[model samples]
Target: MNIIKFSAQFPVEKSCIEHFKAQRDACGVVCPKWGCVHPYWLQNKLCYECKQCHHRQSLRSGTVLENSKLPFMYWYAAMHLLTSTKKSYSAAELQRQLGHKRYQPIWEMVCKLRDVMGKRYNLYQLTDEVELDNAFIATLIAEEEKDKPLKRGIGSQRQPKAVVVNESSFVENPKPGKKPKRVNHLKMLVIEDLRADTISKTVNEHVNPKAELTTNDATPYSKLFEQVKSHHAQAIKKEDLPKTLPWVNIAIGNVKRLLLDVHHQLTNEYLQYYLNEFCYKFNRRYFGDA
Candidate 1:
């Protein structure tokens, strides 16, 4: 939605007390100990008290907007801006758009909201026809460069690896020297190790066992299919060009662009967070006017 529409739908200083009250009461029971239930007092401007423990839990508690000193209208406006845009915005840009004089607070606020959005992402389940792959993420370090010998064996290598596992979905493939058409579907992961154990653990945690799996003919992924109902393998030649699934390629391409264009430099320590943010946005790419 545009700013005008968003403003109309959620006017500035519109009291959220009733909204919070409704959300609180939706639980149907007041059990403060479990952190879900509360009693709404209309006379107190919809202030709620925990029924079980009688503890006071504000409406923003357990929500993304919690602990924010910013006004509710600003928070709502920020959410609208972040969710409505396909292109990710830097904190500086957000600060400018919000017309906030202080950059640090707005930057921190955007990061926090991004964190909430990351946590709220609905990731794919490894149910059927999933793709598994890995990509390298290099960090720019300010040090003299030295030639490091390439290791021959995967088992002996020490380079950090990003293991991506995603579902198979159709995406539009654009032709060269023209606006790219979007097709194909896939998900991804950035991992520290490509070892069988590490990859297997991540898959087990994120993917459902009932789903079919696919990957390149890698030694580490050989036994992964055993744990699931079906596992398939495809081989790619080193000399051959990468024939990626359309949506997967687009997603990865966008991630590469973000790394180069937005962040510029990312370390292994925080690479996963960056990946999560990218994937969250990518998965929601089709949620128009959200």
Candidate 2:
């Protein structure tokens, strides 16, 4: 939803609380002790108490907001800001928008939300035709690993390796000058190494065994056909990314721009969180106004 609609829906703290209560009710909160689905809402305590077992569950107990001291409105507002934009707001930017007193809390909140986004997508496996590629993103070097100041962009030692995959389909029309293709769902994740076992394991984790994999003729991916339904590879240079794997290259470029324009620097420890946010919005790009 847009900022205007979000403000209208959650104008006060009570509104946010009510909305949370309704959501929890719909999900059917169960007592941890007795597995009782029918729980009593303790308005005074702002928690649900099981009638059968007397076990209590706070409103935020099972959610990302668990143990958070911020008001419910702050979470709703943060969600609005997150889902409403393409290149989502950075923690610093969100902190300013929230007008919160401390930067650490806001940063933690955003990271928590990012963590859940990754979990949400992990439930589904990429199927059908998929394009796979790898890219390097700038990251801060660890103190133990830091030897020299690394330059920005592609060949830097300070950059981290990431795998990019897009659920793609081909289409051709006689009226067209060239073959047209469509791509929507995308996934990006940080990888530790480029070994064949590492790449295969990562593929098996996120992609379905029935998927037809497509990639450039990388040495690690050469024998990947044995594990998947089918594999297609093209012998091409790195510069052919835009022309060969259009969607994935576009996503990689966007991520680079997002990091360069928003944050001052990214560390390897939290780079995956940012990728989660980007892919979450990217997968839901067509869900607007629905």
Alpha-carbon lDDT, every model: 0.62, 0.85
In the range 158-273, model 1's lDDT, one tens digit per residue, is: 33467666666433664665323233234456565677887787778777798777667877786787567787776856532135333344466677777777764455555665
Residue pairs clashing, model 2 = none
- Poorest lDDT segment (10 consecutive residues) of candidate 2: 172-181
Tens digits of per-residue lDDT for model 2 on 41-132? 89999999999978888999988999999989888888888888887788888888889889899999989999999999989989888889
Ten residues in sequence with the least summed lDDT for candidate 1: 178-187
lDDT at residue 263 of model 2 (Cα atoms)? 74
Clashes of each: 14, 0
What does the lDDT read for residue 150 in candidate 2? 65
What residue runs in model 1 are displaced by over 4 Å at the alpha carbon?
15-31, 34-38, 42-47, 51-53, 122-124, 139-160, 169-186, 238-246, 264-267
Candidate 2 stretches with Cα past 4 Å from truth are 147-157, 174-179, 238-240
